[model samples]
Target: MSTRQYGTFVVIGSGSGIGNHVAYTFAVKGFSHIIPLARNDWTYNRVCFFNAARIVLGGLLESVETIEENFETTNIALYIVAQWAIPRLRALSASSAAAKSSLLVTNSLLYANPIPQLFSLSLVKAAQCSLVMSLAKTFNSSGIHIALVTVGGAVAPEKLESKKYC
Candidate 1:
């Protein structure tokens, strides 16, 4: 991919996991400003990438409070950030033909293959996928590209044997 050196890149949940890796990759790719928000931070921008999520492990046995908290962290948080980022991205795209603005949200296969042991997480992921699709439909015609990065499993360093597939 060609690097763009002028836009701001924001990654939520950048303290760890996929968020951390994305932030690092964009920085290396020459984004002029890179904002890294931890799971609790609300600081908002361009190329807005949402990866803030919590894994709740109790399934149907999980307390209501726990499930609610999971939704707050994962789904609600993305909505909040999207509300802040979308218009700015739209404006940016309109102002410059060279501008590339996008909203990218990390998702999981749990939304499709529901796991009983992670019921709350599964529910929230489903909600998130729906939200991302809606955003894409609403914004794509205006030049802002909205997408979901649905990860099928945990992200980890590739084992040596996996390199052969590459």
Candidate 2:
């Protein structure tokens, strides 16, 4: 089947991981109007207990604030992108009643299999799942397709130093 069957897509979190692969695959399959959301790199650095503990112990309130800002950025930015992209997706649907434009999210297995130390990520992913589902239900008749690609056992890229989660 041709990827262009969907016309176009809004791929939030396309900067890396499954989102990147999805965007590239769509492009390869003749999708020319894929919109990839660009997020700040600072959001990539998630907080750990070691860092959080150190900050609390050392009275590093600035570091704690930075972490909070990053967490908020990571959590809210996707929704913001989706809010903007949905209208465009709806417009695409209006242009071609047969072709449904998609909002594809890159979710992680952590949504179901929670990691104790990464509790925040788990919570965020769960919330994201809910958001996608709500959008899907709300816009099903509008020809806007909401889809989730849940990634599991995805390893770090070869260039990056791998750290054991345990």
Candidate 3:
């Protein structure tokens, strides 16, 4: 059966892992417009500047996440990605007639349930939660629903795959 009755969903960070889970969930539910924010070893490092930033900063920041290991692609370039991608997705959804259109984020319960090892993830997830809430408040009246789901823990297999441009 479908998780959503009907709608359009665009998932980011769906190369592999949690982000992929969210994308597959929506696809099974029969939602159109699935977009995967993919990355790999080569592009993930060379294209992604987070590590470079860390190096430039001399590793002083302990919270700097590795591109391959981190699901928070929204973190490395939040301002640019969110600004351009999110707006475009919103616009596309606005043009569609799908019911219950929304954005879903895969966060960890590790943050929610409470544990020091996962505190950083929790913080990132908390920020995602806040963003969802803010988006909900801003768009609910306009007919968009936003949900921040905590996946409880990391799971095997991803819902989507990353496409590399050769």
Candidate 4:
């Protein structure tokens, strides 16, 4: 699809890992305006595709500071951006027949299958999942599509050389 069809694509936490790959994928798909913002830089002038997929590695033995950090990056940040984007997305849906405004959050299965070593990550992810579900229930009928993309394992940049044919 053309950029005019997709509008602007904004990717939060695009510094590395899954978020970075998402931004690159959208660019390759001709999204045109792909706004890649750091974890702290959620502010954006334009409203469009919002991908909130920030992650932090934290362990159970870690201090409370680490747990709080995990929550801030994964759950709180997504909530803050959703509050700002939802209305704008709804507006776009109302204005254009073709426009399908969506808020996509990257999630993980660790929320359900918790690991002791990554307990903080698991807790925050569970909260994030709940938030996304609530958002979807409240906004899906209104044309603002809220979705959670759950990754089952650790996320890393794909190596092109590792490609194997089945």
**For this target, which candidate reaches the highest TM-score against the unseen true structure?**
1
lDDT of 4 by residue, 56-86 (tens): 5556787888888778888888888888889
**Candidate 2: residue 18 Cα off by (Å):** 20
lDDT of each: 0.79, 0.58, 0.48, 0.71
What lDDT does candidate 1 reach at residue 130? Answer: 95
Per-candidate count of clashing residue pairs (backbone under 3 Å): 0, 0, 2, 0
Question: In candidate 4, which residue ranges exceed 4 Å CA deviation?
Answer: 1-58, 160-166
> RMSD (Cα, Å) of candidate 1?
10.2
Per-residue lDDT tens digits of candidate 3, residues 1-166? 3434666676655555777677666765567556655554311211111110111111223345442234354444443544554554566456645433445554555445645555454555556556657766876566445555556654534332343222
Overall local distance difference test of candidate 3? 0.48
Candidate 2 lDDT over residue span 73-140, tens digit each: 54467667677877877776776535447777767776689665555555556777787788779875
Estimated TM-score for each candidate = 0.69, 0.53, 0.45, 0.65
RMSD of each: 10.2, 13.7, 13.5, 10.4
Model 1, 73-164: lDDT tens digits are 99889999988988899998887666778899999998899999989999899999999999899889998999998888876544312322
53: Cα error in model 2, Å: 22
Task: Write the number of the candidate with greater lDDT, choosing between 1 and 2.
Answer: 1
Better of 1 and 3 by lDDT: 1
Which pairs clash inside model 4? none
Clashing pairs in 1: none
